[model samples]
Structures are given as structure tokens and as C-alpha cells.
Target: MACVAPSSRASPRRFRLTSTAMMESAPTTRAAITAARARSILRAVSGNLDVPGGEPLGYADPIGKILSFNKLEMNEALPPAQRAKQLGADEYPFFGYPGWERNDAANRRLPHDYMHPPWAGQTCVGHARAVLNAMRAGRPYPVKAAISVASNPLLSLADVRKTYEALSSLDLYVVAEYYLTPSAALADYVFPICTTVETTELWHGTDFCVACPSGIQPLYERRNTYDFWRGLAVRLGQKEHWPWENVEQVWDYCLAPVGLTFQKLVEQNGIFGRREYKRYEKLGFGTPSGKVEIRSSIFEALGCAPLPVYREMVLSPQGDPEIYRQYPLVLITGSRFMPMYHSEWRQIQAAREKRPDPLVTLHPETATKLGLKEGDWTRVSTPKGAIRMRLHISDMVDPRMADADHGWWFPERKEAELFDVFESNANILCPDDSELCSPEIGSWPHTALLCRVEKE
Candidate 1:
């Protein structure tokens, strides 16, 4: 090596060493070298090149897109009010009034009236408000006696009847049911109305996957729910009342500020309007500050918790050991299936086939312990009451838990013969205590209960 200045660089000397005659003669070494060189060449090309298989591809499922579009079209046509009514009827049809010929002595024997005289002590939020207004004006509780009944999500006619009985003193009762109680039963006017699907509804569709429109014709006789209220207002002679003539007009009024028109929507057969799929990219949220508030300031301002907190549920199985001893398994009620909406699908033959009768599902171990088999008639009882259903032993359910498919009542069948339970109503088994209502959302406590089952 020559001693050269650092700046005056010289090309590096190449060194080559020839293998010994013995090594060169080895075919295995030559083959290994050849394979190594081939792999190195492949790695270099693959590293720098964008191959077809490695590239990202974008393709939409065509069938899914078509189904989505059809759903949107149906939603746009029906509206929300109609949808809600349909859902209610679809889940539970009012088979209360059979033809006059069928109302013979045999049917009359069942318990038609289950209402108790209205109590003087009970009061609800609505009743309290009325009382306060009366006190302010120096008058007695106006509009006759007030009745406070439990108004919970997924209510059944049996629940309505129970509430009516609890508040028997009242001239009028307010409860949100799919259709008006028949004129024969209710003294007041029956209001047949629409559901969420039949009205102008605005929701955060992104929360539930697709913000697409859904529409379907009302399967049974129905009317716009808002119109019922509007009609009531008109009858009451309220001068500055609801001005809308039809459901479309109501939609126009609601969406005017957002620059949406019902006519345009109808013309387009429903719009799956542009939406920001990625929530974070749209600037935090539509809140005061453009940041996710782990603690909701809005709720705090309204004297509510900033964060979600759980308080022990009233009448919960965890608190009642006696209930568990009598009813060994906990019963969870009310889960949605595709065919039914809450309690409404009984009217549709096709949907009814999906769940012909109410099923009480239990784990295999629990069934074995109880000496019960699938399709065995079992009586499930709570502290309040009990109902008989066909048992379905399944591993899908927990060993300690059971499920009674909610909303199954065939009024056409004699009450005594319907099920071993009285009235054949599930609500009879649920606690009637109003305290079971959710504190935050004002929903009734439907699930979380202890019950026992006996093979019938």
C-alpha cells in the first residue's frame, strides 16, 4: 500500500483468490453458491419493484351495494313515524278484537279486565308536573284524577292494561303504543298512527354502519303518528296548531334549515347523502371544543354524570338471593331478531315462522341438571309470577342463565289454554315497580332477573 494524501483517493484494490483444485472439484459447493446468488438477485428485484399481488386493490361488493340501494329507497318512501308503527305491529299484532261471532261464551270466560282501582298515593313525573301547575294557579289537580303508569321501552298491551288498571282513577291515560286501543275497550278516541319509518327522522347513521334510507308500505291499517297529535290539537281548538297537511309537509319543515327537500328526496328515491366515514378526520366532534371529552360537559351542565357510571339496578338478581333460590336461572328478556321489531311480527306469516312460539333457551348443563330436554314444556317463574314456554337447551346460553323470547301472545287462543301462566303475558312476571326504570334514559328494566324453571 502506498502512503497517499487523504483527499487524493485511489481506487480500492480488487482481491481474487482461486479455490484449491480439491475445493473447485466439489459439485456441492458450486451448487450452493449458485443457489445463494439466485436468491440475492430475487431479493433485490422484489425490494424495488411494485408487484401486482403486493399492491392494494379497491373493489366494492356489487350485491351488497344493490341491497343497500334498495333499502334506502324503501326508507325514503315510508318515513320514520310509519316505520315505528310498522315495527310495533310487526312485532305484536293487536289480536284483541276477534269477529263478533268468535266472541261467544267460551271466549268471555277469560280475564278481560285486569285493572285495579287507581291508588291515591302513587304519582309520576307527568302527574307531579300537572299538580305543580295546578298549585301555582290555586286550583285542584286539573283534568280529573291523574294516573302514573310505567312507560318503558318495548311495552306490550298487557303492560298498557296493567298501567291503565294502576291509574283507574284517571279519565285519560298517556302511553306510547303502536296503535290506539280498540274503541270497544278505550272510552276515549283510538289513535292509529305511524312509526319512526313513517316520519321525518334524522339520526347519526354513521353510528349504526350505513346512513342509508329505509322504506316499506305499512302492512296493516295505519295513520301518521304526528297527525294523531295534530288532530288532538285541532280538536282542542289550539289556534296556532301544527300547520302541516301531510307527512311530506312535516318533513319539509324539519329539513328546511338543512337545505333538504322531501320532494327532491322522493324524486331521487332516497339519498345516501355524502358522509365523513372516518370520525377523527372530521375535526373531533360537533361539540363546544374540537376534542373528544372523556367527560361529557353537556351532561354535567344538566346535572348528569360527565362519564358513564353504573349504579346497582333495582330488583336485580344480584341483590335478591331468594328469587334465585326459587328461580334457579336468571332470565334475560328482549333481544331483536331480523323478522320482528320488539313485539310486532306476529301478523306476518313469513316472519312468524322464524320464531313460531316463545322459546326459553338454557344451557345443556343446566338442562341436564334440571332433567329437561329441548322442546320440553317448562314453567319459568319469578317472584311476581310465571309463564310456561317450550324449553330449548342450547350451549349458546350460559349454564346459569335462561332467555324467554319476548312479545308472544295469541289473543285468539283462550287465555287459560294459551300457556300454564295466567294471561299468557310475560309482563305479569316482570316487576311492576316504577323504580326499576333507568335513572338516566327513563327506560324500564327489562333484563337482569332471577327465575326458576320446572319441566311441565
Candidate 2:
């Protein structure tokens, strides 16, 4: 049987309907190819070409607007030399803003008077891996101070030992979070941030926009991110830059270009733009090619492979046969759960009740061989480290593969010590070696790695 989901091929009519929808929505050659592949799966399921007649669907072109408004107007409007100074611009030319000026500009006015940060030829010396390196060496310049917002680098980042050492060595570490995460516990100061539930938000999904109104006022000493930043700006003698005291003032400013306020948008429910497909036919893709680049011109210019490829993991059995003998199972991490978002929501009793503990899913056959049964406490280990989790023996995974949920920490544990974040965090198993990353992007192998599981 195909790996395609059952819902994707539930009925012949449904298959044809979705195929037509996909075709209508596909705006580029790349998208068309993806749509075709999806349709091919449906064709395989239906076993005939007789299925017909589904309405052509169209979405409210939000991405096209956002690209034109935010990127083209606000970002690209900056001086070319200034844009060139954005971090990693020299090393990763594809991600640089200087090249993006060639793209089409948006016609819509912006709501707020937003200004790009004047980076002024400053290098992006503070990327994730680079920051860790700075903390380790203190070479180019001593990075004595650090601020973390809605992040838990120690649990989320690869090489827990290195992260711990780097964080421990920092002279000033401050974190803003709802809970005291492992990374937060190491901080010199931990500020209480208001939960998303207490704040208003505007969601831009690229096809449509929704204005969400705040439900409850912030209680206690809790403050929104903007308030925190604005307060900090005042103390840092940058108060002139932050004119807006609250989210309402900021939102109103942002809505000014469209003549809509946060309150007005909330009254109107939401706004959407007209869907115009084949936009490339008129304005062309925002690329040097003026078309969808099958092979990236940027990559080619950088002397890297222009086309994308799928290669076996560097530490996989196929990649390293010697290591495969000792570590057999294919470990996959970063799988998500609906109740929890990444590393958050663990503190909620209801959410925690739904998923009482961290789990590693394994095939029943694999479990039996390793002397593990359903709900058995097991230790999942890699060459880097090990974490204990309950075995959830199911046929959901292949016999040779194990899938574990990431962002594991106990809210019930002592908050003073960050609730034992290291006990079952999946990132502890990943490595951050340069050689182990992608040739172009430097992405760590978070999902695919070699491992073994045994009864703990």
C-alpha cells in the first residue's frame, strides 16, 4: 500500500475534488509538480480516470501582499549598502536582503510607521551556532551579555553539554518566559511574561488575515513582550525609538496604511485580498530569473549545488557503516503533539493530563526483541546522551525506526531547578558538529540520527 493518508483517498469523488483544488491553487511550476504528485496518489487509489467535476478553489492572496508590503516596501526600501550589512549576508547570499530588492513592490500602504533596524555594516555575529561558539571561545569579542525571549536553547538546541557550558559561562543571562524553563533557571534574571491568552494578536496566513482581540487583562506583575521591550528601551536610553506603550498603539499604527485599527478589524471580523494566480506571468518571480528557479541561480552563483537533493544522514547506518553496528535503530525526533506547542503548555494541568509523560514510539516487534513492553520505562540513547521515557509499542513506526516527541520537561518538578528538563529532552541526543550539518544551510540533524532503546 502507498504511504498516502487514508483521508487523501477516502472517496473517488473526494480525490478528484482535492486534485482540482490543488491544481487551481498551484501558482508555479514547483507547486504544479507537487499538486501532480498528490493527484498521482489519488489516481492510484481510484484506479481510474473517470472521477470528474470539482470546483476550482481560490485563496485570498495574503503572501503576495505581505511580500510586497513588508519585504519589498519596508525592508528593500532601505539603502542597498545598509541592507547588505544584515547578519550572514556575506556568507549566505541567498538569504541576504540586497538581492531581494529586485523583486516586485507592493502597492498597499502599511498601517504603522515601521523602520528597519540600522545594522550599519554589522555582521550577523549572533546566529545560534555562532553565539554558542562566541560563548565557548570569547574570541572575536566577548559576548558577556545575553537575552532570551520565548526560547529554551539548552533543551531545544543540539549538544546539551556544550549548551550548558556556554550558558553557565555567560556573565549576564536574562530570560522572559511564562515558566522557568531549564535555560531560564540559569539566568541572572527571569521576567514574567503574560501568556498569549492575555494578549491580542493579528495572524497573517499569506492567504487571509485575522485580527484576534485580547480576552483578559494581564494580571499581577505579568507584562506583554512589547511592554517588556519598551521598558528595557527606556532604561537603556532608547525610549525615543519605542513610541508605542502597548500593543493597541502598535497595532493601530500598523493598521494606518490600510485605514484600519485593531478595534476596527475586530469589528469587521477579518479582511482578505483577491486571489490572483499566475502572478509570475505579469510581475515574474522575485528572482534573478524572473521565473521559478528549478535550479537556484543564487546557489549556482555561490558555487554550491543549484538543485536540491536528499542524502543519507552523515551518522546513519548507510552513511557510517561502522557506527551502525553499535547503534541500530533510526531515531526520529521533533514529532509534535496538538495539546502542547513545542516546549510550552506543559505547565497546564489539563494539557499535562492529556499527555502525562514523555514517550518514544516503537514497533511491537522491535520492543519485544529489546525486552520492552507497552508502558515500560525505557532508555533511548545515542552516542551523545540518553533520556528515559515510557515505551509506547505500536505499529505506527517501522521495526527499524523509533519516533520520539521533543520539548520534554516536567512542570510538576521544582521550578527552582527547571523541572528536570534534561531527564527526557530529545535534543540531548543530537549533535551540533559542523560536518554533520547540511553543506549549504548548516541545519543540524535533529530528526534523523542513529540510536538504541533498552529497558531502563
Worst 10 residues of 1 by lDDT: 92-101
lDDT per residue (tens digit) for residues 212-291 in model 1? 23366544655655565566668898536457666556556544533556665455544443322223233233233533
Candidate no. 1 TM-score = 0.54
Q: Would you list the C-alpha lDDT of every candidate in the order shown?
A: 0.44, 0.67
Best by TM-score: 2
Query: Least accurate stretch of 10 residues (summed lDDT) in model 2?
Result: 106-115
Per-residue accuracy of model 2 over 418-437 as CA lDDT, tens digit each: 67878999999999786786
Off by over 4 Å in 2: 1-126, 415-417
